[model samples]
Target: KTIFPPEGRHWSILEEKFLALVAEGKVFFGKNGESQPGLIRYLSEVEGLVPWTWWPHEEVGHTDESKKEIQQLFGKSAAFDTPKPERLIKRVLEIATNPGDLVLDSFAGSGTTGAVAHKMGRRWIMVELGDHARTLVAPRLQGVIDNEDRGGVTEATAWKGGGGYRYFRLAPSLLEYDKWGREVVSKAYNSAMLAEALCKLEGFTYAPSETEYWNHGHSTEHDYLYVTTQTLTHEQLRDLSEQVGEGRTLLVMCAAYRGDARSLPNLTVKKIPDHVRDRCEWGRDDYSLEISALPMAAEPKPDDVDLFGAPAK
Candidate 1:
């Protein structure tokens, strides 16, 4: 199986391995002893059906066609250089996923993955750092939801979109450092906001009990989280420990505590600055590059400016 005559050398690694496979009847050498056989049976064909590994021009699609699809939807020249064809995305989704599967695209360019997933009845999370996330992505998704978007596999899939998706912007950090490099709770957070933040941080649901001031939220039925900006004394800790009851454990997040909080078995007191200092990259909440800044509208020419209500001149 060597490219050169076997008289000089044994087969190369590829040829040696292939010849070995032939010996094991896994690959077929031609009946007439052809040098390189056409057939390599890696696996038994499923009902003699083979999926096309190579795509024709139509299946994979070209750049021009992709641009056309974009133009049909957006009704203008696309801002992107190479937006993927909807057909290509649909094909990939068909092969790689099933209905109701969750798809995540971190680099969602023109929101094609999300659009395709939506049409295909898949849940998707699309994250884009550019202005397109607000302008392009959000609008495209809204169109899909309203069944107003006609382009990109819509007709082929019989997609009459009727689904819901929630959009959320990342909240700013809850803790930051000051000029003295001392960590403190963010001034942006109020008492209620601080409580909700602490609930999330401590792995508890943000469900404040109406009957109990200390019961901000719960990790379990008996384990509760309480967040306060006030510094606590030993007397306050003792009182809280006693009030927490026999079976309950109270995790109190405060600005400061005077006594050894671990002394009480039922009470676990964590100081705010110390507890959440290393939890996140403090004060560095907005990580997005925001690739495209908002475009300013072109200023109107003197002649083009409206002057219907102007005084006679």
Candidate 2:
């Protein structure tokens, strides 16, 4: 019979470890807690008894619909918001990957993946395009690494913090522009700003680009997003596809493309303006009704006040 624990208090490592030992004939207990010598008929294999890195039910905070969509689209079991419980990520690393395995989260919103991987004895690389990458993600990770929060793994279990992670900011894409808003052939962009802008334009969590090569940016599921204001030639298309990583699809958004869609390998070239129309308001002024220079209550009159005391001046 399978037994389940209470909501937050799931089975601990010590319980599982002891159970495995008992099943393996390594230790013996006589009647009424009396110690007895054990004879080993077969060595108990504890391979399956490894502690499962699973977040308890209470740790999962996503709603049924949102959770379903995220799982269907990204294959990531967790949601994409803050306060992403550490227990959930811990479970993911435990079940899907082995120790020292490289876990990657391009949309590392709050660095939950990094935190859990670190706790579970795994290596991790995460990318966050939001400003919180520095303000929130870094601090949260620092808290995890330094054991600042007493309620994390240290309080829950035996946690000896030692390792650390290096932080990096993605560089900008558009560095140099001609007077007519065209990219100069030789000019380079500031890496940080370019990375940020590209992520904004293409809806990516992180942008990976070097000088003279603004190749790709990636979100969680989608990768190799290319955005160009100009038309793409066959050679440029081929070069772009080559620069993109292997086994991943390339999503190219440009004004026009002169390549055969069937010929390109794992290439999805979208011709903007024709295939997709701009839905955003252009050159429209939006004024807030609440932002008014006029006084809310034009100078309070003496008659406006109801004086309880008898006063007539």
Candidate 3:
């Protein structure tokens, strides 16, 4: 129905458009019957907006391609079953966020989210609970930063990379329940960590004072917090009340208290463990990735010197 006879095609409505194409040899006739019009247009350019509702299976890539991408970077022998293709992540990033936006991956297995985000110029955070975080994610990100990683979207994105990222480990828990179900401060906490834990619990910053033993930190200049494991007696409380003076408030967190805390108008006393135990899900250790189930080098001892033994330069 779109095709028209010569007279119909030459009508003023259609002639202007067709005459130019005919003159330019852009129009053509059917193979056997020279009367009917053949395909007139040249090849079309690639579509700008390809609907995501249905992409050709070939364009979206397959599981095999994803594995190949990882293998290319890690090596032929190294493979991960759940690695996501960078192209898919790239598509998501393109649609969702802009450059320099922060992306977080809580369960960062092989660091693909971090890798793809880094390649696309987005800031990223990847938290992995296994020791493979050290063996896999860190090295993979480092490779991406150094441009040493030539696989994944490198060819498609032309990612001659340049960027940086920092690594950090979570601190141990501050409290735990004993076998008898008594709440106790974690054995792993050092003096400073204990102080920091108390500061966090009491809603104070951990700013220790050089001159004042009682001034661990403060919520305001008029209100301060003190944290200690020592049992506080009435005499100690009286001394602390005098130190706090007339207008200031002092919140003391201790293992045990023997004083009438209410007698001191500006002082508040809280028992540690008893007050803090129910505050959080205690004893939850944040561990880095392990490449294998086998034991790693024994966890470094607190007082033990360097395993390498050589002094720092």
Candidate 4:
């Protein structure tokens, strides 16, 4: 509108849409309970439409259709043994979830879940450790963006293709040892990981500054948090405070600190181990239920005992 405004800077398609929505009795606050643009309920009324679970392949697509979809998206070479038809996924979404709900596919095979979710206007997270994550999923998603591959629920959903996605290469899960001893954590929380965790814990955004050493995250523009494994001395804290200066406040989480931490109002100092310990269950590896030892069952006396070690009937 900024580039192609017919009525100079006074025209807005949003205003027209709002008026049209008002006439249609659909304009209201967004799902987040805010009367904001973009999020505001527009023409989409099929959000939580519950479809039946007993869907036949005739209604949705069958395994043949799934293979056809793969061929259309990728190629004949991308023949999956049990490919999920897009219509099947659509029905699943209709039955289980509402639009805008998050869908997680742990093993994204041919990235069917993600593709369907994208078309159906649902947020999705696809975790794929295999080679196809890059070769198949990436290309498929790019096709979704370019509005090329129009098989499956594409026609049903009328997907115009305008959303963006982020791709992350996660570190492989490995056993990690802490300073105390060899302990098993699912994934070792490094310094950055610790900082990110602490930031979320303290209700701050995990945004590390490139230039500044102290700024790890921030709740507000002026308020920041710094996480470290080293024990901070009073002198160090003083230097930090000086660096931070007035107006801005910093939350410093470390292993240990000497002298009074409450001396500086700007720097809120906290110990890492105790607080972090409270956040998680660590140290012990064994997580099984402990079976208590029972005393040996007393032998029955001759007077009470029967033929089969029971009282006579």
Off by over 4 Å in 1: 1-29, 33-44, 47-57, 62-82, 281-313
- CA-lDDT, candidates in order: 0.79, 0.58, 0.78, 0.77
Of the candidates numbered 1 and 4, which has the greater lDDT value?
1
Clashing pairs in 4: none
Alpha-carbon lDDT of model 3:
0.78
| Weakest 10 consecutive residues of candidate 2 by summed lDDT | 303-312
Candidate 1 lDDT over 1-313, as tens digits, reads 5334334333233657555656876554467565544335433532333357886758767777778877777867555676888888888888788899999999888888999899999999998888778888888899899999988789988999899788877667788779998878888898888998889888998898898888899989899998998999999999999989889999999999898877889998888988887565545768976858878888643223211122323
Q: Per-residue lDDT tens digits of candidate 3, residues 1-313?
A: 3654343223222457556657876556656546454334433622234347664546656678888888887776768768888887787777777898999899998888899999888999999998879988899999998999988777777789788888888887677779997778889997778988789877898899999999999999899988889999988999999998999999999999996888988889998887887576545687667767986788543213211222223
| Candidate 2 vs candidate 4, TM-score winner | 4
lDDT of residue 313 for candidate 1:
33
Candidate 3: worst 10 consecutive residues by lDDT? Answer: 302-311
What does candidate 4's lDDT look like per residue over 1-313, in tens digits?
1223223232234567546755775544456645332213323633343456577888888999999889887789877667899998998887777899999998898999999999998999999988888899989998887888788898899998878799988653323556766433324678888788778777999999999899999999999999988888999999999999999999998878998978888999988766656676656889876667757788744222211223223
Winner of 2 and 3 under lDDT: 3
Which of the numbered candidates is closest to the native, going by highest TM-score?
1
How many residue pairs clash in model 1?
0
Roughly what TM-score does model 4 have, to 2 decimal places? Answer: 0.60
Compared with the true structure, model 2 gives a TM-score of 0.37
